[model samples]
Target: MRFLFIVQGEGRGHMTQAIAFYHLLRSQGHEVCGIIVGKSKRREIPDFFSREIKAPIHLVDSPNFVADKKQKKILLGKTIRKNALMAPTFWKSLKTIHQVVESRNPDVILNFYDLLGGLYNFLFRPNSRFWVIGHQYLIHHPEFIFAKGKPWDKFLFQLNTHLTALGAVQVLALSFLPKNDLINSKFRVVPPLLRKEVRKLEVKTEDFFLAYMVNPGYGEEVLAFAKSNPLVKIKAYWDKKSAKPIEYPLPNLSFHRVNDQTFLQDMAACKGLACTAGFESVCEAMYLSKPVLMIPVAGQYEQACNALDGEASGAGIASNSFDFSLLEKAEKKDTKVSFQFHQWVDSWPNILSELIVSAEQESGVKNPDGEFDSSPVFG
Candidate 1:
């Protein structure tokens, strides 16, 4: 079967999920027709994705709903304002995307949380089946549990979910937590998608701590904590303006950009982690049996809930702020959760294939189950 994958190129998480799905499909003897990546001026496509993903990549200008740094929150007003301004560009991109999809005539169209997917469904009305797949899609399910917070904040999250769900044939919500009220609506619960590389990497418990802050605001706080502790070797990944392999005055601290090979290598060697409570990173850390100190970005509800869930599951400690004392205490004790992630990893490919087949059949697309039903190609 030929599949067209639409991805939101906001962070490493979406791209990683795409990479995982791409490999899984190919391994199952299905062909990925092409990839449509939403491009943001603020972010550059990482080298890792370009080099690793074999499919042809096309860029389209899409709406980006980003956090407001000044307010230190996700300003729905600002998000709407910015997205409104980009409407023309978005329309143009949509036209191009529709042409690409029509040319490919794919068996199914899979979306990796691209807002453009909603727009694509709105504009193109393709005869091909469309399925939305991502962790963010969990928000749309009625079974998802929302952390108690300001009413407006909660409303905005719901609004975000609703917007993403517009015209989606099926929504796949990925989570490590149990399904709840928010997740049970309009979506099927799926396990977190992890890359084959991550699954294959050997886990080793070393003395060093792994730290990553994709947000620059938290870089100084983490660096200070790392610097204060001379006894602990800190291999931190920072998103600051700096050269690679930047050695700090502190003997045991070092920082690098998003170097996949180095990051995975360090993760394998780290005893534990001190990082922001991002879903993918935390999942990877837990898979490697590394306890984490989850310092969520202030005013980011998702990260806050992630931190709370991580703590609840005994995977890590949650800190209201980045504190060296907290890190010191967490380091002395072990809080790794013993979970069978291998089961999820092994089942993902089959699950994804089944979903694509189901969606295609519903849309009356020919070759609905694609190559999977015809023969056994992958071991």
Candidate 2:
């Protein structure tokens, strides 16, 4: 079977998921014909995608969030306005998606929760079967707890999830903690898609912490912490524009641009991961049996939910700020959760096979070549 991956190129999370699934499909004798990633002005298609995925990647303009002056919080109004102004570009990108799908003639299309993927499906109504995967879909689960006192934020975040999952036949909801499937809905609770490199790291008990910040503002908090504790060392990764290699901001702190290998190596050696509550990084930290101090990005309800869920999953404690004091107290995290996590991670091939086949049959689509991955969606 042939597949095409449509990814949201906002951060390393979606792209990393795509890389993992691409390898999984190939290992199962399926071909990934092409990849289409939605691009944002603030982000660059990371080197890892091309260096690792081994697919012809197509990048096109898509809607993205606009951050505030501090680059910490999402400016919802400004974001909508900016993307509204780029309406013409997005429309063209939609058409481009149609052309790619048509030319690739994939057996199935997988969406990594890309907004353009949902919009294209909703508007273009292409005949190809589509499956949507992301931790965001877990929001729809009955047992899924959301952050309180932010009904409006939760509503908007869910709206975005629905938009990205608009026409999906199967919604693969990645979970921080396993829950029962959504009864009578096109949702399945699946393990987080952790990269192979992360799973294979040789972890060491180091003294310094690994800090990953999607927003640059969090670095100041880390820097402030470092200033107070002059002896403690911090290695932080940020997507700061035009940043030099070694950004020596404070005596005990250094900031590096987002580099996959460097980040993974640091993850192996760090005492704990002090970062935002993005699903992917937390999962990676857990797989390495490293504790985390998660600070959810401001106004992102999804991250708030992730922070809470990650805590429940025994990833580490959650904080509203980058306070390294918490790291010292919680340095020796338990390894018991890792056994269950690895068990869940190992089950993806069979689970996804079942879901893909189920989606194809439910959509009433069959291949012209009489080839179908009729394997059971579950063992």
Candidate 3:
């Protein structure tokens, strides 16, 4: 079968999921015809993704969040206004997606929660079967628990999630813990799409703590922590394009650019991880058995939900600020939970293979050539 991946190019999480899925499809003797990633001017596609995925990537202008001056909180109002003004550009992007889909004509189109991908399917209604993938889809699960308060935030987040699933026939909801599939509603609970490299890592517990901030704005908080605790070493990574290869704001504090290999190595070696509540990294830390401190980006309800879910799954403690002290003072984390989570993650291969076939059969879409397409998604 031929597959085409449409990924949202916002943060590292979705792109990493796409990379894992790319390798999985190839290993199953299926072809990935092409990849269309929705991008914005705020960020660039990481070098590791292009180098690792080994596929032709198409970048299209799409809606994205607007951050405040500190680059911390998500400015929902401003974000809507900005994307609303870019309606014409987004329309062009939808057309671009259609053209790519028509040209490649894959057997299955998988979207990693890219709004443009869903919008494209809604407007064009292509013949290829479409499926959506994300942890966000788990929000509707009866067993899922949401963060306290923020009713409005949850509603908006769910609205965006729905928009991204407009024409999807299957919703693959990635979860930290196994749950019964919502078959009646086209939702399947699946394991996290962890990359092969993660499994190959030699885990270790080093002296320093590691941190990853989706927005560099939180670096200030990390710096403040480092300043107060001068003896404790800290290694932080951020998406600051203008930053140096390695920045040392203080003798014991250092910041590095977001590099896939380096970040994984750090996660394996660090005593604990303090990062914004993005799903992938927390899962990585759990698989590596490293305690985590998740501080959700303000106004990002999805992340707030992630922090809550992660804590319940025993990833680590949740905090509203970058307080390393909490992690240090907190009681020992549960190793049993980590063991269970690792087992859950290790089941991805068998589970995903079976689910993909089920999804194709459920959609009733045959391969374009009456057989699996042998041609590669990229040359």
Clashing pairs in 2: 354-377
Global lDDT for candidate 2? 0.84
Q: TM-scores across all candidates?
A: 0.85, 0.93, 0.94
Worst 10 residues of 3 by lDDT: 370-379
What tens-digit string does per-residue lDDT give for candidate 1 at 119-181? 677567776666677666665555455667557766766665555555665677777654553
- Clash count, candidate 2: 1
Name the candidate that leads on lDDT. Answer: 3
Q: Candidate 2 on 12-74: residue-level lDDT in tens?
A: 899999999998888788899999999877877888889988878898898888998888898
Clashes of 1: 13
The clash count of every prediction, one per candidate, is 13, 1, 2
TM-score ranking of the models? 3, 2, 1
Model 3 over residues 1-379: C-alpha lDDT tens digits?
A: 8889999999999999999999988888888889999886777789998998877799999889999999888998999899999999999898888889989998788999988877787778788877889999898789888887888887888888888888676788999889998645466888998898999999887888999999999999999999999989899999987888799999999999999999999889988999999999998888888889999999888998999999888778999999988777655447787678778888777876886677556555447768632221111
Q: State residue 225's C-alpha deviation in candidate 2, in Å.
A: 1.3
What is the Cα root-mean-square deviation between model 3 and the actual structure?
Answer: 4.6
Runs off by more than 4 Å, candidate 1: 65-76, 140-143, 177-186, 240-249, 324-339, 360-379
Task: Rate residue 347 of model 1 by lDDT.
Answer: 69
| True lDDT of residue 282, candidate 3 | 91
Stretches of candidate 3 exceeding 4 Å from the true structure: 183-185, 330-335, 363-379
